[model samples]
Target: MAFPLKFTLVTALLLLAACRSDPIQFHTLTPAQVGDHSRTTVGVIQIESISVPPQVDRAQIVIRQGNSGLAILETEWWGATLVDELNSALADQLSNYPAQSGYSVRVDVQRFDSVPGQYALMDVKWRLRSAGESEPARVICRSTLQTPSGPSIDELVLAQQNNIKRLAALISQAAARKQAGCLMPVN
Candidate 1:
């Protein structure tokens, strides 16, 4: 009968609609276009280790909803873990330092806050030491890098990217000079 056929068709359509879900979106911290490589250095920069906060170290990007709330985005994910993303991004950017002093950097992220339509903030404690040196100049510094972002997810990622770029620059400069001790907080 036409009634039975119509009911079956409606059920099939409902099933199809229920099965459709939004595709997962993956993002990365890698720069779209790398900078010039003409800086000629003695050795390459090695990102020794990167440690992010437990709250934001997963594949999904965590956003600070308010003063004390955190929202984990299920559908949006990073290409890799948060630590891996930082290691890759820092290695990529620091490779261009014009300094001859090769060094290794270790970063411990105390707080990685991402807020939609507000800002992306990175509060990290980073250390740099010369490579292959018996007594290397060890420098430890903490920096709070913040960048304004738009409401979109892409904009938030871009903001975080900018923070990474700035951190790379600071590490590059520090390694170049071979600081003897801890420095003040950078901007």
Candidate 2:
């Protein structure tokens, strides 16, 4: 009886372990090295924004398809919904590159009012300046996913989130490079 009980316990433990899934994997990125803590106030900066039309219903990527090279059952992942993920990512990325002198940066739907001499004109526009230039005068930036096949909603969200993050980095870098003294990067 003791032996049977021990075997059952071991089997149950093993089954439980097998049923558990591994954590989703992702790559790590280190923030760039920029020196100093300073403060600069940006007055009424116009955020020229553009959004890549959402491709919500259409599958941007396909996974686990059958041998037809890329054909299989289609599934939608949750994360690829739309703006929420992008906005979060963009905010995170831009947080590091703050406008002069450690001033608090604000972004919103309403156009900011410039106080002539007090506010400096910062045009945040979006344009294909180069292969991957961040929008020049846009506050919020957007891009559409180029899905390979039908991806699960989770996968879509992850992929889109990652893309937004990457774009944020690129845009920040571009802004830092272009605007002489506009934004000061985090040390």
TM-score of each: 0.89, 0.33
Cα lDDT tens digits for candidate 2, 63-158: 322323332123322234323333444555555555322212222211111121222111222332322234243333332322221233344333
For residues 73-92, could you state the per-residue lDDT of candidate 1 as single tens digits?
Answer: 99999999988888888787
Clashes of each: 0, 30
Give the deviation of candidate 2 from the true structure as CA RMSD: 14.3
Model 2, position 165, has a per-residue lDDT of: 47
| Residue pair clashes in candidate 1 | none
**Model 1, global lDDT:** 0.83
> Each candidate: what lDDT?
0.83, 0.35
Tell me how candidate 2 scores on lDDT: 0.35
Query: For model 2, how many clashes?
Result: 30
